[model samples]
Target chain A: MDRRKYLELFLNESREHLEGAGKQIEILISGGTGKNATLKEFYRNLHSLKGMCAAMEFRGLTELLHAMEELLEWGRAGNSSRLLKTVGTLETGLEEVGALLGLVENGDPDPSSRTGVLKNLRSRKKSRKIDHESRRPRNSGGPSEKPEVSFPSSIRVQMESLDRLLESTAEVVIHRLRLQRSLPPASGGPPGNHQENLRQSIDRLRAEVMEIRLVPFGSIAGRLRDAALDLAKRREKRIEMEILGTEISIDRSTLERLLDPLFHLIRNCVDHGIEPRQERLRAGKKSVGRLLLLVTRIGSELRVELRDDGRGIDPALLKDRAVEGGWLTPQAADRLGKEEILRLVTLPGVSTHREPDEVSGRGVGMDVVATRIRALGGTLDIDSWPGRGTAFRMQFPLTLAILDSLLVQGKSGTYVFPLHQIESIQEVPVGELERGRNRCLRWKGAPNVDLYSLDEILGVGENPHRKGTCPVLFLRTDGSRRGLLVGSILGRRDLVLRPLGSPLETMREFSGAAILDDGGIALLLNARTLLPETPGPH
Target chain B: MTKNVLIVDDTRFIRTMLRDLLQSSGRYRIAAEATNGREAVDQYKSVAPDLVLMDIVMPEMDGIQATVEILREDPSATIVMCSAMGQEALVVEAIHAGAKDFILKPFTEERILTVLRKVLIPQAASPKGSSN
Candidate 1:
């Protein structure tokens, strides 16, 4: 194989590492906190670059990266002040790497011949270390804050997705050619099968494309764990993070947008919520703090419960902070209940931390977290017990473009409910229904659940189930279960849920409109909107 | 029939080199190429290739983790670990993870073929015309 052929691939992949490290260096120079995490990322990139350059036998690149790594590792071990002083040298070293790569790119078979850059870096590193050895070191940062992470965080357009698209295209082409023929279609012949093949192919293509847009939570779990471990190490706190439902995958865009907010939450817990090891032990708790990122699907929504067993936020502190920050008067702060006061964390400029530091708990990012979640069409709720812990539960709308929905007949016409939310469809006799203002329902060998008419909720038309019976669709939300009465259970469909634009979007009862096969449209009901929080009959 | 092979490496250079070496021998077919271990596992499951040439220290689940995952799913899977010099420790870990044989980076055509042949057909890599 030609070495130059490898050069392009080598350059593309290796440049990514170099660029990633260079970006971290820029952040460090800009006085970014999480300096430990930044340096860890820097070292990781260099280590990766070393491995690659070594394989390619690019001695100059290897030597430069190796020297840079030694200096970075030393600086990460509690000499950030020294690192601050060497930013120029580090920047020059990075530029030297770029220059070396440029030489390789220009077909220099022996880029190793130019060893001037490596020598300069080594000489400078020696002098800097000797100059810094006399001064007492400050905080001895953890060896490596972020442990080596090994999981693909982003979804790639791989052969599988491409293959599916190709197969679907081939199917459509074959069907088109078949339709072009004048011969009548054969009932069971391979030569002239129905358009079902095209339909099946199209459906498969839609599904494959959606899957491409969704990434398994486990993909990003590696970094989340890394961040948690990094913070725990830097803070010198013992924390165990358990991430459940790794199998649950969400929209790629939503996942990407969430990384920062999730990081902020983790930082908040570590900085403010979690007590140190000795503090935890003194509080009669386990020496190590426990954190859980539990994701579960409730009805049609995804609920992510982030819970940490640590020193939970004290509402009194929040009250004081709210008053001191002038966001709320002392009387107004006192008027808030425990839950309301805790929610003040999501209010801008309301932080209970004694002092603000890097990462979070400066009363800045929590509000941003809330705003971001809201922008994603999600809700955030926090509750904490001072000595116990804090639990934050975020609910996200099922924003997948393709929604599996259950179509039901109503007096207004037909509507669709997200199939995942519908627990069971039961035909309830009129006598079985405790009808009136507050309708209640009972089913054979099932727990009694409150039932309301779909018409009453939508006010689209008169009730169609006043006579004989109705099909009650059971739904389970977070901490509650209820059933809604519809004309009847029509069927199920894989709906291409199109968001209602502008004027109609204001109607929160319907999230998106599902265009039916026969020029008909079914409003995909938002289950959250329909649950009007009537006191639970249970 | 040419043995189906899946080349796994983030560095396209290594992947391309391995592909050329394996295909030039005319004994292996390139079933797929994955840039990382997660993709490797996915490709392995989907393509079910006869052999895998895996590189360690790549991003998002390195060869050792990918090897463990693949072997766990299919105990009989045949995987060949690839490492640069000074990654012998990683190679040992990969071997313990059930990779059959190993190859070094800056690959020599003969070396890769020998390792692939040995792993693919233990008795085939004989003193005679086995490599061919």
Candidate 2:
């Protein structure tokens, strides 16, 4: 019931929804009328995200996205050039929301950061401008009558309820914790009495509080499907977007935050994945391109898989690009695996288009999508078969509010790693660690990895242990693998994740902070951040 | 024979460029120049110029209003409206306001001459009683 935790979730989710709307609208603009349905979908999605943000009591995000949704709605109803310009406005709004979201996720979100976009949207007043200028009379009547762009009766919600609920829940949690601690220890009572009852009730209450943050997946997926239709039409290609698992429940904030990556993957599939009708016909396939988006749950994680049946990736082409970009030599490129080729497509500024075109395949967008996904502690995988099709799979947690972490003791203090990122922990004998330039450990039958000291990493050292068996946590980041050295492993448990303020947030290694049962702040270290920065090809 | 020309525009850079271009030819001499349409009408009356190059979107009365006023003073006077791509409809309306022709911007020397030659020569060469 921590307010900061809820706020972090809300900010993150709102960002995702805003990004999704931007990507969809941009595609609709580039693809033209064939993307009309997608344009409407984008407008509706913005409205929906706004509604959800309002329900979550994120007033700033709600206000911003609401105004943005109105603008998009006005744009969707207009013709080609108008829609393109409107989408540009949408991008500006999205950028403002993105900057604000970064602030909120780090705590201390600046509400005034987005006044310019809001002011611009309000003053633009598409309907009034169109009506007044178009219908102004030359003779007796003074000015032209403009068509009034009206906001629909819906999209508004009561924020007071969410605020009240947050306050009451926080009070109840504090009270319950106080009462539990006050209970007498080791009293000659049955094991399943008052304490067990209290624990059961607390668990149920915590579950209910978490459930309040869950948003329906359908709202996010609806806009992506619409965008695919619009993009396909514009490209003169047939793309069918089939959404699976639309009713799944994810933290409303997570659903919103996940939109940019999800929408990009869908747009990429339609724009770059599917070939034109003539190409499809020449390839001896149906004219209609098939794009499937399957959002399914795998244990505690949700997998958003977007698969397309068009022209798949050519490893040879990717290899050529890598060699051309000097990322690798011809010999090294030939030795590269299939997955490596797919990874190249996600590299910043690497587009598949030999010549830049307004439409997709000019790959500047996917890098942003990859970064957003990574920021949310998600992993994106690309699988492609030449002449077949390409499928992008992104797996992420359903909740950012709560994280299961492995708390570890270091020289400085106790630090936590999200359990998913910890590949394995091994008690390596001190003798096995060969001292080198920067704590490199060479284990039998394993690659040599750099040893990262938790205290050294956090910049707070109190001598964790000079001589003892050190526990090594192996982590994988973007394909680069590394090991972290912690003084002691403290098992795993679920903790309510809270964002750290800007002062301490400069520490990129730590994602955020969480409060332990003893009321001490634990640093939640992002495993990927722990990896040493690899030097780019010179 | 040298013809008198009136130049109307908001930007000093553009007015200077047009004045230099027209005067450099030695066949045309600048009658007067105005920054806005309101001033343009006053200049047009003072000079009674043979031709006028007018900008459409200027402060203190647009070119269309000045064109109407200039035509009201003398129906024989020729005024060409300067416009950009986004202001095509406004250019059409300016033509209906009794302007003779339009020159698009950012101006090239060739385009300016073509529009100017068409607007000035055709009307000047026509029989005095012929209806346009």
Candidate 3:
């Protein structure tokens, strides 16, 4: 690979390292014990990051991680003397790395200088030496010495190489499926059996490869907590962070993509949702504000919520802002539900703050946050009361690897509905279908969302009635409940999802495509793509 | 040579930068640097420097215990405890244990030189009684 490619890989890996550091800092701040194993793992991670950064000749990142590694190792040795200061420096260093990454992304890479801070710290360290001796009474337990860290050679593979290998494996599997179908079923019996066996083995191998791609959600939660803590400190608000369901994991790439949006949400909580100490006191709330990050696994979905008990969003003010931003009319705002009103803050270019702070307000908006959440096959929901604070809930696909999809028959092909999004499927009789306005069904006493046949949405010109298949899969997208109409229901199974090529990406209905065991392309439905707009009364 | 001072800190960059700045002071020099408490104690015995700049909290043997050891070895030894914020208690403990003085971390030239002159000057005024 070219130097540019190497730089790209460095950027990606550096991001992961920063994220890990951010999370570890959160763990430390939350009063979680720096367990020996965790510390050793963190130390090794920093050491590896430093080594790779040095090899890549990204001196700034290398130097920063080297400093952080020293701090963490000291931490491992149970040094609390200047741990907080070191943590602060590490936070700033991570920010600098972010800035450098941005520069690299924009084709202007400057590693910048750490000389100023480094010099200051060095002087402090050296000056302490004279004092270290004078204070020692001379007879003590002596010095503690430990063996050096040694790494096994087997773990030396670069992340990009791992990624490339997975991608190539996916390609080969796809091609193999194509070849198996092309062979005559009876004529190629022996060879067909061999291909079938190869397919099963490849499927198993793909599952393992996917496991390597996962990064535990605990890390993402930790980083968000750190960002929240920093903001709380800056604003002089006393807030505590606690994370639940930390052991639940997500793919590394998805977790990385989540950092920015999570940071923005926490910023909103600190800058907007959280009030000053006096304000909070007068509101009959405790002086110390509480922000809770709750992560829970709900079946196939992972939900991360940021809940703050500060001053909440005012519905009236939200209405005013929505109207001012041209997102709502006066009459329309009156009839909006509380949930609906709460979502106005998430509108593109809309902010509730009368004066935005430098940290929270930038050119890009929460629309980007929503879009990012959507891109990961996730949905974001906001709930708030007038004085009870706000909570932003982001629900993501449990994993980005192989999805268990409910394959539904479309006229041209099978559309794979991510099983996570499917609430339930029912065979609604044709007579039971409410034909007054759109394709809704009156099922089990509740009026479920109207379902649209994939043929209708894809404009495939397949008449659902002509096909004589009536299976409706209820779906929850963007906080609204809806249903998708499909020709037939194919039972759930695991599929190795593959990204669509550039040419096919314009079709937004499906997020990606995956190969089936019997050799066929099943389109993975983008559940968020088909959210239903609130209907007007007839 | 240049009034050798042994530096003990966990940060390498900090150690190197300190070495550079103190060398520029024209009155003091860094004899050796150790990244943690254990190495710091070893380096101190070997260098037998004129002064010591000790970080209060370090791996293995902290500045308090380190200060206790050095003072026991040579009561005449001049040691200054270096502390960061939230280390007030530790600094007091280190002082009680026999540290001559202390300087907070991320110190500027003024702070560094002032603390050094206060702790390193052998003939300087005693901190008003209590000598071991």
Tens-digit lDDT string for candidate 1 (A347-397):
788888767786675799898887666555466779898899999888876
**For every candidate, what share of the true interface contacts is present?**
0.42, 0.00, 0.00
- Give the Cα lDDT of each candidate: 0.72, 0.68, 0.66
- Write one digit per residue (lDDT tens) for candidate 2, span B1-132: 576789997545446667777777676788899978999999988877888999876656778899999999889888998764345787889888878777765456666776676567655664642222
User: What DockQ does every candidate get?
Assistant: 0.24, 0.01, 0.01
By TM-score, the best candidate is: 3
Residue A381 alpha-carbon offset, candidate 2, angstroms: 1.9
Residue A505 Cα positional deviation in candidate 2, in Å, after optimal superposition: 9.5
B1-132: candidate 1 lDDT, tens digit per residue: 578889998766567767887788888889999988999999999988888999886666888999999999878788998776556887989988888878766567777787776566542433322222
| Candidate 1 CAPRI category | acceptable
Model 1 regions lying over 4 Å from their true place: A1-193, A211-214, A229-251, A276-282, A286-288, A295-304, A313-386, A393-399, A409-414, A435-447, A458-464, A478-480, A487-490, A498-523, A533-535, B1-132
Tens digits of lDDT, candidate 3, A1-538: 1235456555666667667766775665555785454455455445545544544455555555555555454544556645555555555555555675676678764364333332222222332322221131122111121112221112234567667877786676667656766777734333554665477668878878877776677877767888888889999988887878788777677778788898888888888888999999999999888888887877767788989997888888878988988987899999888878877877877766778678888324677777667666677788887788888898877666567677778788887888878778877666555542543334442364555666766777543754334777778665567776777887776667866755565444656788886777887888766543553232
Per-prediction interface RMSD in Å: 2.8, 22.7, 12.0
How high is each candidate's TM-score?
0.44, 0.46, 0.51
Candidate 2 vs candidate 3: the TM-score winner is: 3
DockQ of candidate 3 is 0.01
Question: Stretches of candidate 3 above 4 Å error?
Answer: A1-149, A152-156, A185-192, A362-364, A406-414, A423-427, A436-439, A443-463, A466-469, A476-482, A487-524, A533-538, B1-132
Q: Is candidate 2 or candidate 3 better by lDDT?
A: 2
